[model samples]
Target: MRNLEIRQFPCLSDNYGFLVHDSESGETAAIDTPDADAYLKAASEAGWTITQIWNTHHHFDHAGGNAALKAATGATVYAPIYDRHRITDVDHWVADGDRVTLGVHVANVIHTPGHTLGHVVYHFAADRVAFVGDTLFALGCGRLFEGSPGDMWQSLSRLRAWPDDTVIYCAHEYTQANAAFARSVDPDNPALADYAREVGEKRAIGLPTVPTSIGKEKAANPFLRPDDPTLAQSIGLEGSGPVDVFAEVRARKDRF
Candidate 1:
């Protein structure tokens, strides 16, 4: 089978739009519709037909362009079952463990409820690629908008179970700010220090720091290291449970 080709482009002010294409079947899936015009232009530039729209959540920037894109390309729209009522123009409502295909590439829909009550990430297991829409970021995690800290921790724990080699494509350009916050709570971590340096360099040149790997985030992301003693002590919660530690970290980030 041919490999899936992904196109990532900037949309809105900070959002990123993705197009996943499979050459063998000649099908393309738009990961989200942050901007229908942007998706259409990107698809045109790549010479790929938009056959499907896979929405991760019901946020305005995520699904706001659904109707326009569908009307333009007649593509099928797949959205999270939990967010069906929030998003419109959905052709299929997928749940956790459900599978969706584009040509021969099949992506597993995993419910990651933290950024939104029904946020779902698409993981292409064989491809070792995950499209995490706001659930997880380069050096941070999504804010506890709809779900509690406990709920978000559980969601992140599931993502941490993926193989270290998995490549993660998060939906925002928040790495610079996240790196700064990470240094505050995880200053002693050499890995985080190095990652922060790299982020600084990348941002200085107007480069995008997205598509970070699972190993990197697992090693340095403060949100994913609530159980680590160093991080707990940094926030004065040396012996607290992971959930409580996570809550403190999330609260600090909110105020950051």
Candidate 2:
């Protein structure tokens, strides 16, 4: 908290742009730039000079701002090695286990390849912070754009393994839609219903529903709750494996 500060803003309609700043070192980074101008405006308001661009995947919404932001701020760009062909201007192509230094903070890269074959998240373990691009959302996980349901399920588990207090910074404002899908599949889940109501109220006020804690998501997010007996049973997948249950849930969401 001392050296690291984070600012988030809306971009590209539903996408959320984030800027991370190191107070002591004065190095700030834009995470998965949904919009270059939005990131720049937020950084400018915070009086932070963008020094790095950290990309989570190759998706346009995520990396569309890479070139413009880098050109304007001369920020060093870091991207997943698996998708460097599509995600351009990456000064450092990183992979799982790679460490990136943001001033004195060290971020460990976690390769979560379900969203994309090369999707990766930046986890600053020491700071209990993670910037997960499109891999996981508030109440929902990303659509299986390029990976199997099993792949996404495994990736979610990696994030779940982190401390419950880890603050998840994900892109997008899809909680309302995800919550609706969850209730349709797991109607008896009180936790999910309660959280969904809260999300609705927040959205009504044009508030952001992100930066949710891993613990909070663990309790209410159906995508991450495949292990719950009620959730499995509601979807008629009791006794099934998490991957299988996850697949069913994702398929239902695809139509929802």
> Which candidate ranks first by TM-score, i.e. highest?
1
lDDT tens digits by residue: candidate 2, 37-75 = 988889889989999999999999999889999999999
Among residues 3 or more apart in sequence or in different chains, the pairs in candidate 2 whose N, CA or C atoms overlap within 3 Å are: none
For lDDT, the strongest prediction is 1
TM-score of each: 0.99, 0.97
lDDT of 2: 0.90
Number of clashing residue pairs, candidate 1: 0
Tens-digit lDDT track of model 1 for 1-256: 7778999999999999999999988899999899999999999999999999999999999999999999999999999999978999999999999999998888999999888999999999999999999999999999888999988999999999999999999999999999999999888999999999999999999999989999999999999999998899999999999999999999999999
